[model samples]
Target: MFFIICVVLLLCYFYMRPTVPRSPSCLVGKTAVVTGANSGIGYQTVLNLASRGCKIIMADVADMEKSKLDIIEFTNNPNIFAKHLDLSSLKSVRDFASEILKSEDKLDILINNAGIGTAKNNRTADGLHPVMQINYFGHFLLTHLLIGLLKKSPSGRILFTSSLVAFTNNLSLKTLNFDLEKPNYFDRHFVYGNSKLSMIMAADIFAKKLKGTGVTVNSVHPWLVKTPLFTKIHAIYKNVFFQMYIWLSQCVFGRDPWEGSQGLVHAAVSRKLKNATGKFFGDYAPWRKPLKAYNKQFCKEIWDASEIYVGLTPEERL
Candidate 1:
């Protein structure tokens, strides 16, 4: 069919899209931390930074020993280390930050890259929505805690792995409730979108807060790579043929993970972006603006609400 032919052609084009070459700039003494660094975009981004001689902390819920060893062997970067960070729990996030602050003198890059495609409509023990907690609020707290350490570096950068799904997140303050209180709906897809949108909103707010502090804030969308989370979510419906079709489409059309990570790599390390802040990298040209960003009053309200939800004390407020 003509439609099928066109679909195949489109897949070929995405498959052929050019990859941003790895940066030649070195990060010899700089320290960077990436969550969800065991796999997907986080894994590839860590590899890219490791190749640049950066000391990397692979923070995730997974057992990070093997992943750290693999990167160490491949890049011959001895400074790569693994650290446990379970973003679903606020205590885990705080503990991770505490460990980092006590051990590392400074942090140059912090990529809030850990995220989930679906969270099964659950709530974290902190009484926050699971996807929102893992995708946005957990990073929210982590960044707030590590901000001083980031400021300790001569040039610091924070990057959030937002998603294109943000464009569809038509969220209001009530629906954005972290605790899933009464009158709040729990649509998994929309929550994911809302979380991504929240991330960009945080970047915009942080860019303003960190102004003139030598730290830059940005967010990136790692365009539809071959992640299995959403697929599993839909497969729960038990549709046999549709599941096969899903696998086929992803196999034939998904961007390779390494190529998908280039925009993040560029955002995290490229010298050209040293002064770039409060921006979105929708792709490798590495710049786009989300619709909800820059609305100062609205964003400020969201930030204030987030501070309360995450239980940040007066002293921890940025």
Candidate 2:
């Protein structure tokens, strides 16, 4: 009986996942930026906010013309625009942030949502782990640069799309330097875990840093979804057997992108959470604790090191 109940519960968890309710909260004059807006949950989140009449900026490494047109057509909300952001490159991140600061007076929402599932050992032009840069450090820099603008709004929001996989990470200041050095036995299963954890750690830190600014920093575990993220990872391998493994895993663990994005939209616009910050939200808004969510000293050490890694100037320090 216990075994049957466990199986039933798992099935229900997957199939009966809640959708983010339509938020009655008004966003008439707000402007939001979503990285990874080219596809997956990021795309869906953009659509959700656009429908609510928030001016949307679709930022991604890809050419956003087609996706932008599609969202505009569907939402009939013409305020959506596209911008380029290549997170793996520090220069690109700075350029993007600079452009935003010069053009937009203030940014109301910032979603650090671009991510990948690749496990290949590689370093970016910035001499950091490509995965870590794209998933965490790049956004860290962008957020610092844009902190001023976010503070302009009475209740600006900065949401990081962390994952349950973050719980699996075992990290330190030393291990975090995976740009040239690597974590022991690094592979696909563990490649993305640490990056996710770093994001949550960042949220913990920022939630404190922005305490009096009325700027909330929160993280959400958007749940597993077989989005093109896995499809892109599949292209990384040539062996038939490896491809099959990837496909089988997604088949068992993934949900639709729309469903996976529910937690994010809920975290983004839910009126109930207007003043909430430093919270780690799970699928559909259940509170999920972050890994070492309160390790302030460790997070600060990593933050200082990250500032050096990202080449932030003294004046840029927040």
Candidate 3:
């Protein structure tokens, strides 16, 4: 009887998984900046914000023309514009932030959704690890640089795109060197996980820093969605027997990009969660308890290390 009840409850939960609706209420008269907006989860998130009347700024490393075309296909709204941002490059992040500052006075929502998960063990133009720089440090720089603009809004929200891998993958700060030092393939998972862990820590630090400033900061684990972002991994892993494993895993855990982005949108606009700052959320609710390493001291250390690595002190950026 208990087993049957558990099965019924599980079935209901799957049957009632909440979908991201085109609600006109969440984003009326707002200005939102979304990174990696050209494709995957970022693309779906951009569409969601735009559908509710938010003026959208789509930033990505991809060509502006390509991003613009994608936006056109997704939404015919002219309020949307595309900009260039290579999150792996500190200079690129600075340049993109500068450009946005020149054009927009205030930013209501800044979604740091751009990320890379390839196993190439690469580095950016900057000498930092490619995944680390792109996933965490870049967003760190961008957010700090634009905190003033975000604070210009009545109540700004900074949403970071973190992942569940942070809890599962092992990391050590000694292996901080870039592509040349790390494994090119199998070990890429740890790098990805490290970057995401850094992201969550950064978000927590930002939230604490902006406590009374009305600029809330948070991070989310958008589910493992099957998007073009995973094409490389999927293609590489899709062999005769691996395909079945991938399929079964995805069936149980993966979701579409739109579904994955719900937590982000919820965190971005939900007034009921006004006190949700600094908290890590997944599937649109506060994570029960963050990993032990996600404590305040770690966040501060990561912040200091990041500032040192990026050569931008908090006062200097201000």
Per-residue alpha-carbon lDDT of candidate 2 for residues 52-122, written as tens digits (9 for 90 to 100) = 89999898999999999999999999999999999999999999999999989988999999998764667
Best by TM-score: 1
Q: Which ten contiguous residues of candidate 2 have the minimum total lDDT?
A: 180-189
Tell me the tens digit of each residue's lDDT in model 1 across 22-101: 56789999999999999888899899899889999999999989889999999999999899999989999999999999
Worst 10 residues of 3 by lDDT: 170-179
> Model 2 — TM-score against the truth?
0.90
Once fitted onto the true fold, the runs of candidate 3 whose alpha carbons sit more than 4 angstroms away are 1-16, 19-26, 64-76, 176-186, 236-244
Off by over 4 Å in 2: 1-16, 119-121, 179-185, 237-249
User: Distance from true position, residue 271, model 1, in Å?
Assistant: 0.6
Ranking 1 against 2 by TM-score, winner: 1
Can you rank all candidates by lDDT, best first? 1, 2, 3
Q: What is the Cα-based lDDT of residue 240 in candidate 2?
A: 94
Candidate 3 C-alpha lDDT tens digits along 1-318: 999967875786586466653333556678999998888788888887887778999999887676666666676666888888988789998899999999998999999998877645466668788778877888889998899888898889999998888875555455444445647444676777777878887888788889988899988988778777666666655365655766655665678888888888888777777667988887777784346445666556666778887879658553
Regions more than 4 Å wrong, model 1: 11-16, 178-186, 234-249
